[model samples]
Structures are given as structure tokens and as C-alpha cells.
Target: MTDLESADRLTEARVALAEAMALHEQGDLVAAERRYRAALAQDYRPADVLPLLAGLLGRLSRPEDALHAWDQLLAIEPDHAVALHEKGLTLHWLDRTEEAIASLERACALDPDNATALGNLGVVLADAHRNLEALRTFRRALALQPDNLHLRHQVRRLGSGAVPFWHIPMMNDAPRNDAFEAAIKAAIGVAGPEARVLDIGAGSGLLSLMAARAGARKVVACEMEPMIAEMAQQIVAQNGYAARITVHAKPSTELAVGAELDAPADILVSEILSSDLLTEKVLDTFEDAHRRLLAPDALVIPRAASAMGCLVASENLAGYAFVGDVSGFDLSAFTAFAPQRLPIHGTMTGWQRLSGDVELVRLDLTQKKHDATLARLSVPVTASGRAIGIVQWMHIDLWDGVTFDNHPDGYHDGGWLQVLHSFPEPIDVVAGEVLDIAAGHDRITLILWPLPRAAD
Candidate 1:
């Protein structure tokens, strides 16, 4: 090409670049994008032009176009931190999570000291439900900018989101801890010091630590929640049981015989029971452990758990289960939507028992499998009142002679709360009468229904 023609092309490209910058500053995004593209077509310093074009595209609400612009810039300057970071943001906006994470991760790696890039990476990780990785990324950003309130908030939010609120209170419950420790000690005693133990749902690493303290040589524990699992590992290390306990941040179902465990565990200790017993999938967890993680004759802590309760009649308790007559209106139909089971602080909640304590259902944890069960229970009435529901608590039979019951009368301020399994509707009965009720579990839930007098 002639020198004059080349010079004229260079002048035209510089003018396009200058016009694009001016249009971008004036908020004329469409015109700015046109000018930026014109400059790029003329090959006028693309490394600089691409970012401005991409930023303009993002401002114009064209995330896909912005991503293409960023990609073009990345193809030219692969290590361009700004291009990588903005590409990550655009990908996230487009709901392409995995790619966004990869882009943001690259940005952070290229610019290790960039707090904004690190924070953005954390946000993408969190959006993808990789909360543990997000928490770690936030912590890294926090380390760089120690006084960043947003980063601190992200850390706290992720940590809380990963762990349940009841965990701390459950940990502080001395009675529950003692019962579990007694069970762990007994299992270790029976299996000897060399016993291999597996603890599922290792909250705070307490159960595994108990096993370690009981002289179990190899204790493997798994917690599904990553934050809680990490905390458990820290607690285990803090309590000097790190050498004995190996905590995996995974569910027991994900654990394998040759990987997480050297061999089948001699004892299986898990406390994943919810207030109502089945909500946490305790049966499924135990069944999986028995099938894949434990020996055929492994000693299972809480070998049996029984749902114990008595018929209850309480004005305060009834208010929670059923409602009616609001502002002289019959809101009784709304009662159909009332909670089937209400959690009640047994000692603090005022209630009267219409019948003596009766065992509603008992779960044998040692069994390899369980089917849904329903049985007829006839409760002999001792007092007369409107029976709102059966206020029930758990009676757990741990290792030989180690049993714990959160009985509504005496057990209070513990991890377990007595659950009021409400009836389909209120029933009135006289003293010295038998109220036949269908009581059992459908594997995943407790089945409690009041039967008709004729059926009884």
C-alpha cells in the first residue's frame, strides 16, 4: 500500500476511537457502540477499544453482546484482568454459572490483590450453590480488605445459611450430650479400643469426639453441610481429637468403604433425628450406613427410638393447632390449613393430659430396612376434655441401659422438643372411655388419625 493511503487509514481509525470515547462519556450508548465497532473494524488499538465497547454493551443492557466483546478482548490479551472480570459478570447475568465461575476464578488468579474481583468470584460461587467455596473466597477478599463490611456480611450470611439455627442450642444441651457420650463409650467398650467408628451428621464434631475420647482408634465422620463440617473439623482439632477423627464434608451416602473408611465401621453413631423423627430422613441415613458403611453387626447408637405421648387438652395449645370465630366470622374452615404437628416446649407450655403416657410408634434402627407401618392404639382416657392432639416426645434406647427421653413433664431446655401431633379435628370424650387412634409412620412422616367410635 502507498504511504499516503496508510497514513489516511491511521488518521481515520484515531478519529473513530476519539468519537467512541466522547459518545460513551455522553451516555449515547448506541452511537458509542457504533463508533467503537468502527474503530475495531479499522484495527485501531483493539485491546483498549474492546473494554470500552464491552462496558458500553453492558451499560446498554446487552449482556450477550458484552460477553462477545469481552471474549474478543480476551482472545487478544488472554491475561487481561478487567476483561476476565467483566466477562464473568456478563456470564453470571446470562445465568451461565459454571462459565462465570471459571472466568471469575481466572480474574482472581491473575489479579490476586484485587478485592473486587475476588468478591465477585465469591458471589458467582454462591449463586452456583457452592457455598463453601464462596465462603472461602469471601474470606480471602476480607483478608485483603480487612474492614470491608460487605465482605464480612457475606461471610456471616454464608456461614449461617449453611448451618441450622438449632445446632448451637442442641450442642449446649448437657443431657443430650451426656446420653450420646454414654452410648459412644459403651459401643467402644464392647468393640474394644481398636474399634473403627463412623459418625453421620457430625454437628460440632461432638459425637465423633466422644467416640475418640472413648478410645476408638479410627473415627470417620461426615456432615452434609459444608460450613458445619468445616467447623466440626476445627472443633475436633481444637479438642485434640484430630488424630483420631477424620471428618468428611459430605453425606454418609457419598462415603465409600475403601475411600473414607479403611474397612467397615464397628460402630455407627448418628443423631440426625428431627423433632418429629422422620423429617431428617433418619431411617434412610441409617439404612444406607448399614448397607454400605457399617459392618453387619455394627453397634448402632440409639438402637431404637420410640415416639411417646399422651392425649392432650390445652387452651393455649389448641390456639396453635386450630383457629375459628375471627371478628364474629366463621374462620373454622381455615383450620384445615393449620399445622399438622406443632413444636411445643414441653415444660414451659401449659397442657393437660387426657390419658396416661402411651407409646405411639417405635423405630428399630438396627434393622437393615423398614416399611411403612400403621397400628391401632387404644388410649384409655383418664380425664375428660376436648382432645386437641397427642403431645409426643422421643424415647431413645442407646447402647445397653443408656436411654434418653425428652418427656414433656420433666425434660426441658434440651435439644428435643415435644411435638404435638394434632388430630384431624377436635374430639370430646368422657373419662373411663377408650379412644381408638391409628398411630404409626409412613416411613417419611408420622401418621396419627382419630378413628370413628364404630371403627373402634
Candidate 2:
């Protein structure tokens, strides 16, 4: 090429580069993108211009174009950290999470000290629902930038958000803890210290720690939630039971007899029951434990748990369970979406019992097998009122005599709240009339519904 033509081409590329910078500064992303591409076409420092173009494309909400620009830069400078980071962001915007993770990981490896990159990586991991990994990434970033409020917030959110709200309350519930410890001590006394105890859903390692404190030599606890499991491990170590208790961050179903446990556990201590007996899949978890993880004659901590409830009427609860007229509209149709069950602290909520406590369903955990069954329950009403539903609590037979119940009358401030099994609609009953209900479980959930009365 002639010297004059080359100089003209160089000047044209410089002009395009200058125009792109000016346009970008003016917030004219579309024009800046055109000038950037024009400069690149004229071969004016393609490497430097590519990042600006890619960023401009991203600002324009053109992820595909930004991705292409990033690829072009990466092809030229394969180890460009900023390119990789921005590319990861664009990929995340495109919902290409796995690719974004790979790119961000590469960028992090290249620039280990970059807290912003690490934080972005954590956000992507969280979006992918890889919570434990996200929490770890956020923690690493937080360690690098301790004073960063966003990093601190992310760490706290991922760490605390992964745990259920009931865990703290359940841990602080002295009565509940005492009851479980009593049951564990009783089991350990019978089985001896050599008993291998398996604790399913071991939140905070409380139950397993109790077992270890009660003289159980070997305690294997499994929590399905990884965050809670990690905390349980920390708590066990803090309580000096780390050597005796091993907390596995895996669901009970994933645990095998020889793998997580040396052999089938001699004692099964699981507090997987929800406010309502079966919502936590207690029956399924227990049945699986018996079938795989527990010895045939293993001493189950709660040998039996019965769901006890009474017909109730509560004005405060009615608002939560049913909705009728609003500002002016008949929104009662929205009642179809009302909650089937509502958790309530019995002492705190104002409710009147229409019938004495009736046994809705009973699960014998020692049976090793359970079938979903429903039967007729005749609740003898003692009060004339509008019955919303049955307010249910639990009566757990932990061992021979070690029993616990969250009876609404006096048992307050415990982890176990009396759940209201809300009905489809309110029923008005006479003082002496009997209310029939279909009461049982579907293995995973308790089935309680009002049955139509026979012809008057």
C-alpha cells in the first residue's frame, strides 16, 4: 500500500476511536457502538476498543452482541481478566449460568484479589441455587473486603437465609430441648454408650449433641440443608462433641448403612416432625431410616407421635383463613386459595375450643412401615359457635414413659406451635351435636376435613 493511503487510513481510524470515546462519554451508547465497530474495522487497536464496544453493547442490552465482542477480544488476548469478567456478566444476563460460572471462575483465578469479581461470581452461584457454594464465595469476598457493606450483606443473607426461621426458636425452646434430651438420655441408658445414634434433620447439631452428652459414643447426624449441616458441624466442634458426632450434609435418604454409619444405627433420634405431625415427611423419613439406615430393632426416640386437635373458632384467625368482601368487591372467590393449614402459637392467638381435643392421626414410628389411611372421627362439640377448623398439637411418645406434648392449654413458648387445620368454610354447630371429620394422613401430610352430617 502507498504511504499516503496508509496515513489516511490511520487518521480515519484515530478519528473513529476519538468519536467513539466522545459518544460513550455523552451516553450515546448506540452511536458509540457504531464508532467502536468502525474503528475496529479500520484495525485501530482492536484489543482495547473491543472491551469498550462490548461494554457499550451490554449497556444497550444487547447481550448477544456483547458476548460476541468479548469473544473477539478473548480470541486476541485470551488472558484478559476484564474481558472474562464482563463476558461472565453478559452470559449470566443471557441465562447461561454454567458458562458464566466457568468464565467468572477463570477470572477469579486470574485476579484472586479482586473482591468485586468474587462477589459477582457469588451472585451468579446464588442465582443458580448453588447456595453453599455461593455462601462460600461471598465469605471469601467478605474476607477480602471486610468493610464492604454489600459483601457483608451477601454473606449474611446467604448464611442466615439458608437456615429456616424455626431453627433459632426450636433451639431456644428449653422445654422442647429438655424433652428431647430426656428421650435421648433414656435411649442411651438402655442402649449403652456404644450405641450408634443416627439423628435425621439434625439442625444446629442439638439432638446429636444431646445424644453425645447423654453418653452415646457414636452419633451420626444428617441434615439435608447444607448450610444448617455446616453450622451443625461447627456447633458440634464448639461443644466438644466433634470427635463423637459426625454431621453429614446430606438427606437421610442419601445416607447408606455402611457409608455414613459404620453399621445400622442402634438408636434413631429424629425430630423431623413439623408443627403438624406429617408435613415434614416424618413418616417417609422414618420409614426410609428403618428400611436402610436403622437396625431392625433400633430404638426410635419418638416411638409414636399422635396429632391431637380440637374444633376451634377464632375471629383473629378467620381473617387469615378466609376473605370475603373487600373495599367494594366480592373477593370471596379468592378464598379458594386460602391456606390449608396455619401455624399459630396457641397462647398468643385468641381462639375458643368448640370440641375437646380429639386424636386426628397417630404414627407409630417403631412400626417401620406406614400406610396412608383415613377414618371417621366424631368430635363431640361442647360449645355452640362457628367452627373454622381444628387447632392441632402433638403428643409424642419418645420412649416408654418419656413423653412430650404441646397442648394448647398450658404448653406455650415451645418450638411446636399448634397448627390450625383450616376448613373450606366455617360450620355452625349446636352445643351438643357431634362434628364428623375424615382424619388420617397421606404419609407426608395429615388429612383432616369436615365430613357432611347425615340427614337431620
Candidate 3:
């Protein structure tokens, strides 16, 4: 073709591109997309035109079309950050999570300073239940835009979402902390300043710090949650205990004698007991530590833990434990699926003792082995009322006389809440009657059930 003919074609393409921009500015998405596509067909600056077209299609809720446009742009400029970011978003909208994460990750890598891309990547990772990765990504974005409240909120949200909600309150429990510290200090004092101290589930490195403050020269802490573990390391450094403490982001089962620890720990300090006692796999963790991570004569903090509670009647708690008639319908059968145990703030929840507090089960943490056991418990009723279940709490036997219990009577605002071990159904009892109960531990949880009363 002659120069004049080529020039005319180029002029027509430029006009189409200009019209597309004008239409896009005016919110004429359909018209804008047509002109944009027309410019691309004429081979007029396809790189710039494709992104505009794709974004417009996405606005029109045409993800498939938008994906195709993004693909076309990527083919021209494979490392285009904007194209990759938008494509990742489109893929996420299409429910292709893995692909979306890959694209968003590439975009973030290519444009390291793009906080929006990093935030979007975090969102995709979170949706995939990869919370640790999501948290790390948000942290990176927050570092880049330190004052961004959204990024800060995302960081806190993901960090908290990855761990339990009780951690903060648990940290604030001064009595619990004091008990553990006393035990740790006593254990360290007995083991000597150079003793190797190991803390399993070292939340916020609090106990390890306590051990360090108590003159423990060497402390190895393990926390399974990576985010918490990272923070623990930071806290250790912040408190100038980094030289004395090393935090590993691993479960106790994964720790080795010479790897995470120089030798079997001379003092084992772990606080993994759940509200009901063993739901946090304290038995498995302690057993594993005994088998692989501790010295044969290691001083174990909280040498024993007991599940304790009393037979109780509570009109307020019964609502949480049972279901019967609801809005003119017999919904009592639904009670079969009610929560076996309900956690309640001891002093806040209204309840009256039907019987004195009884030791439901006791675990000798220093013992090397634990087997699941269920036995008969005959609870003598002291009050005439309908007993719903046992109001269970914990009594932790730390070093020497260092003990802590969240008894419903006086314990308040502690990390540990009292748990109500609801019976299958409410049992009516007399003041002098003996209520038979089957109470035990299935390794990881407390098992409390009302046995059928013998013919009275």
C-alpha cells in the first residue's frame, strides 16, 4: 500500500481509540467496549486498549470476556502488572481460586510496591483458608503503606482469625500468669540458671519470657501457629531476651533434641490446657514432649491438672443446654444435637450448686503415658433442683503449691471460663439423692453423661 493509504488507516485507528476513551469517560461502557475492540482489531496500540476493554467488560459483569481480554494483553506483554492483577481478580470472581492466587502472586512479585495488588492477593489466600500466608502478605502491604488503616485492620483481622479469640484475655489473666510465673521461677531456680527450658505452645513468648526473667539462661519455645510464633520471636527480641530465648514455629511433636533444642529440656514449661482441660491436645503434646523433647527428670510446670465441677441448676444456663418447645412446635428432639459443653464466664453466669464441687478427672502431666478412662461417679445431691449438668472448671497443680482454678464461686475475668458439661437431658434430683454420672476423658475432651438412675 502507498504511504497515503497507510496513513489513512492509522488515522482511522487513532480516531476509534480516541472515541473509545471518550465513551469510557462518559460511562457508555457498551459503546466504549465496541470502540476499544475495534481499535484492537485495527492493531492500534493493543497493549493500552486491551486493559481498558477488559476493565470495561469486568464493570459490565462479563468476567469471561474480561479474562479473554486480559489473556490477549498478557500475550503481548507477559509481565504486565496491571493485567496480571486484574486477571487474578477476574479469576477469583470465577471461583478459580488457585489460578487467581498464582496470578495475584505474580503481580505482587512484579510490582513489589503495589499495596492494592498485595491486598488482593491476601484476600484470595484468605479465601483459600491459607490464613498464615494471607497474614504474611497483608503484613508486607502494611509495611509499604504503614498508615493505611484498611491494611492495618486486615493484618489484625487475619492475625486474630488465625488464632483463638481467648488469647488476649488469657494474656490479661494476672492470676493465671502469676501462677505460671511462680511455677516457672521455682522450676528454673531448682534446675539452675543454665538449665535448658522448653515451652510448648509458647503463646506471645510469655512463659518463656517469664523463665528468662527468672534467670533461665536457655529457653526454647515452640508455638504451632506461625503468626503467633513470629510475634513471639519479635517479643523476645523486644524484651532483650532474644539471646536467652529461641522460639520455634512448630508443634512439640516436631521438636528434636539437637535441632530446636540443644538437649532434652531440663525444665518443661507448657500451658496448653483448654477451658475443659484437654481439648487443646495437651495430653498428646505432653506425651510427645516426654517421649522426645524432655529430660527424664525434667521439672514439669503444672505437674498435674484436674477437671473439677459441681452438680448445678441454672435457669439461665438451661436455655443454652436444652431445647424443647419453640414457637408452638415440639423441638425437644433438636436438643439431642446441643453442645455437649458450654463455656461460661464463671462469676457472670447465674447458677446454683446442687452439689459441692467434685473432681471429675485428674491427669498427672508428669506421667509419661495417658490412657482414656471412663468410670462411674456418684454425685450426692445437696440441693433440691433440676440438675442440668456439671459446671466444670480446672484446677492446675503447678510447681509446689502454685495452683490455679477458675471456680464459679470466686474466679472472674480469667482466661479460663467454666464449662457446663450438659447432660443428654436435665435430671431431676432430691437433696439426699445420689445422681450417677459417667465422667472421664477420651484423651482430647471431657466426657460427662448422666447414667440411668437405678430403681429408686
Q: Which model scores highest in lDDT?
A: 3
- Give lDDT tens digits, candidate 1, residues 198-292: 99999789889888988888999999898889989999999988899999999999999999999999999999988888889888989888899
Question: What C-alpha lDDT, on a 0 to 100 scale, does residue 312 get in candidate 1?
Answer: 87
**Given candidate 3, what's the lDDT at residue 326?**
96
Weakest 10 consecutive residues of candidate 2 by summed lDDT: 344-353
Comparison by TM-score, 1 against 2, better one:
2
Each prediction's TM-score versus the true structure = 0.88, 0.96, 0.95
Error in Å for residue 100 of model 1: 1.2
lDDT, candidate 2, at 90: 93
lDDT (10s digit) by residue, model 3, range 40-155: 88799989889889999999999999999999999999999999999999999999999999999999999999999999999999999888899889989999999999989998
Better of 1 and 3 by lDDT: 3
Ranking by TM-score: 2, 3, 1
Local distance difference test, per candidate?
0.90, 0.90, 0.91
TM-score of 2: 0.96
lDDT score of residue 67 within candidate 3: 100
lDDT score of residue 439 within candidate 3: 89
Instruction: Let me know the TM-score candidate 3 reaches against the reference structure.
Output: 0.95
